[model samples]
Target: MIRARHAGVAAGAAVLLLLTACGSHGDNTQSPAPASSTDLTHLQKLVEDAESAASSAESDMARE
Candidate 1:
C-alpha cells in the first residue's frame, strides 16, 4: 500500500538522521608540541632501567 511505503521511507530517514547525529564531532585543535631533548633522554633512561630490571627478574626466575 502507499501508506506502508511512506512509513518505510520515514523509518529509513529517521535511522539515517540518528546515524549522522552519532558521528564523531572531531575537534580541529592542534596537539601539544613534541617532547624536548632533555625529557626524551630521561624517558629513554627510564625505559632502559625497566628493561634491565625485567631481565634480572627473568634470570632469577630461571635459577629458581
Candidate 2:
C-alpha cells in the first residue's frame, strides 16, 4: 500500500516535469535561462511535495 502511493506520486512528478518542459519550449521570455536550471527548481518543489504526500500517506495508513 505504501509502495502504491509512492509510485503514484512518482508518476505524477514525472508527468509534471514533462509538461513543464513542453510548455517552456514555446516561451521566449525565459529563453535566456537554460531549461536545466528552470527545471531543477520545478523538480525540487516536486520533491518537497512528494515528501509531504508520503508523510500524509503514512499517517493515513496508520489510521487504517
Whole-model Cα lDDT of every candidate shown, in order: 0.53, 0.73
Model 2, stretches more than 4 Å misplaced?
1-3, 11-35
* Tens-digit per-residue lDDT, 1-64, candidate 1: 4344444555555554444435444586354444556755655565565555556666666787
After superposing candidate 1, which stretches have Cα over 4 Å from the reference? 1-29
Q: What TM-score should be assigned to candidate 1?
A: 0.52
Top candidate by TM-score: 1
Q: How many clashing residue pairs appear in each of the predictions shown?
A: 0, 0
Which ten-residue region of model 1 has the weakest summed lDDT?
A: 16-25
For all predicted structures, in order, the TM-scores are: 0.52, 0.49
Q: Which residue pairs in candidate 1 collide?
A: none
